[model samples]
Target: MKKGVFLLCLALYAFSVTLTIFVQAAGIADEKLRLLSSFGSLISFFAVLAMLFLIFRLKDNKESKVKSCGQKQRKNPDEKNPSKEKYLEFAARNGLSRRESEIGYLVLGGLSNIQLAETLFISLATVKKHLTHIYEKTETSGRKEFAEKVKAF
Candidate 1:
């Protein structure tokens, strides 16, 4: 994360420097207006690049998390939860308690165990226990893959 921010800052700095150089070189008759345009363009370019980078990073994280959860689930098949047609069905099939089911849902939604616990008003230890049960039932080894399976259900 720090690296990403650093890179973005570096990119912005380089862009600004380049824009200054270009404006100086163009030496248009309207020096003030040309400098302004160059500055504006640089700002716009950097903004677009930053937005794109953020979106890409978010998407990549989500996909990777999903993959990790799925791989975990595949590693253990003995803990097959019940097969409900709906998302609720997943909870029922898995024999997860009401709270466990809720936690599981959150986990499936890409929340970390700590995040889920906080959201659900539970202790981290309790959250881990619930996750253990969830993993056992869902046969997921990681949060990402578990989330994928839950989403599919």
Candidate 2:
């Protein structure tokens, strides 16, 4: 969409430039009319250039935001969580399956059951079932105990 708009603006600018040159070469007798026409064409040309610049800037900002968001989501599990290694070790020690360990990580990151379901793209009941299995495997009573045990590691 932005590219189309930019192209259209470019075409309009080119047309305006050609028209202005043609008008200048036509040798009109009225100086005032010629000056007014030149000024109008100049203004339209600058407007088209401004629109193109703004569109490009907007596209750049949108692309940067999308890239940053993707990077942030992918990096958060390890980079932002200081206890990731400890959690992994804890998971390994407890013989947690991959899914349970993922749930554990999100739980440690302070996600609620609903958030866990949303983040993991699972149903709420599935999240609860995973938590139950995690609790049984880790031999912890609940989230608090699990978190305490992992942190103590």
Candidate 3:
């Protein structure tokens, strides 16, 4: 009976040790998985950065090649619009919003307030409001003076 009891105790101890070893191994594997996941994220971040760098480098290279080949860079339409610079200057001096500046430029084109409202998809009252502001800023009495000033600019 003593021998049987001793053997049973030994079997229980061995089973407990085996379980502890497996638990420790699982913990090590978990740590390794976390490390691998962090590395993957870091690699992907650098890959994206590298791709952006390459894209910008290629764009600059193309621009330089164009310059070397004597191809004139296309001018923006805004640059060609003679009144655009004057409107920009007016906006800067008057602290006008972009929409107001656009409306002012259109007013200089001989369009009435009602026509402006219809063309810009706004109500007549809104157009009149913008015009009032524009007139005050430019110190103009009416459309004739505004057009004359813009043309002089």
Best by TM-score: 2
The 10 consecutive residues of candidate 2 with the worst lDDT sum are: 66-75
TM-score of 1: 0.41
Candidate 2: tens digits of C-alpha lDDT, residues 37-61:
6875986778687786978898787
Positional deviation of residue 70's Cα in model 3 after best superposition, in angstroms: 35
Q: What's the C-alpha lDDT at position 38 in model 3? A: 52
Better candidate by lDDT, 1 or 2:
2
Write candidate 3's Cα lDDT for 36-142 as tens digits: 55555555455455556656766676566434433222233232334577678867787777888888776655466666675676889999898888888888888
In candidate 1, stretches whose alpha carbon ends up further than 4 angstroms from where it belongs are 1-85
Q: Candidate 1: minimum summed lDDT over ten consecutive residues — where?
A: 70-79
Provide the clashing-pair count of each candidate structure. Answer: 16, 0, 0
Pick by lDDT: 2 or 3, better one: 2
Candidate 2 residues lying further than 4 Å off, grouped into runs, are 1-82
The lDDT of model 3 is: 0.64
**Better candidate by TM-score, 1 or 3:** 3
* Order by TM-score, highest first: 2, 3, 1
